[model samples]
Target: MKSKKKTLNDFGGIMYSTDPSFVYEDKNSSPVEALANNQQDLRVMLDKKNRGGKAVTLVTGFIGTDDELDKLGKMLKTKCGVGGAAKDGEIMIQGDFRDKVLLLLQKEGYKVKKSGG
Candidate 1:
């Protein structure tokens, strides 16, 4: 069985357009270019909310394509030897590895900042 991918309903439930000049545009058609590592501003934070009391290190503020984000996430996970996820411009590390992640990102030339307490 093939899985269906979900997409935005940009038509707003409109069935037809009377105007001949009306053209449907896909806002997400263009992919966002990935920024340089040094130009990327990233934040590493430890979050415990909505996941019981277990803390997870979240890396946010990544301005890049999904593939680049996934690669970075995979590298972090492999280096730290932990499981996590990366999506919607955010990377979630399974544990409180803020210091480690910060250093790793710095070595990778990313401008990283530690956020939250």
Candidate 2:
């Protein structure tokens, strides 16, 4: 009797490879390209939702850590002169401040993407 060996692709994608010694390598050879890739990863999504009968715009993104997020949120709220809160690792500001938020994020050296109309 022969035993059947399951391959990585047979089960799922690259993350579920059966090979224990598998190592993934990127074809991007330049360090500058890698940095650009990292920069592109920083994105912000703006969403408007009703909270307490008011429309609140939620800005979500990867901004290092909680401390950084808190600092940024505080700065943004102050500059925008609006009420907001940083909860659940996201920034929630009152009203539609997409353009203002985008400018603030750019000034802080983050590549932000504004989504939603």
TM-score to true structure, per model: 0.80, 0.57
Task: TM-score for candidate 2, please give it.
Answer: 0.57
- For model 2, what is the C-alpha lDDT against the true structure? 0.65
Off by over 4 Å in 1: 1-9, 16-24, 27-29
Q: Judging by lDDT against the true structure, name the best candidate.
A: 1
Residues 43-64 of candidate 2: C-alpha lDDT, one tens digit per residue? 4455544455676667765434
lDDT of 1 at 77: 98
Candidate 1 lDDT by residue in tens digits, 1-117: 112464445555666789999987755556678889999999999999998999999999999878899999999999999999998889999999999999999999999999999
Looking at model 2, the pairs that clash are: none
**Leading candidate by TM-score:** 1
Residue 104's C-alpha lDDT in candidate 2?
Answer: 82
Worst 10 contiguous positions by lDDT, candidate 2: 28-37
Residue 11 Cα positional deviation in candidate 2, in Å, after optimal superposition: 28
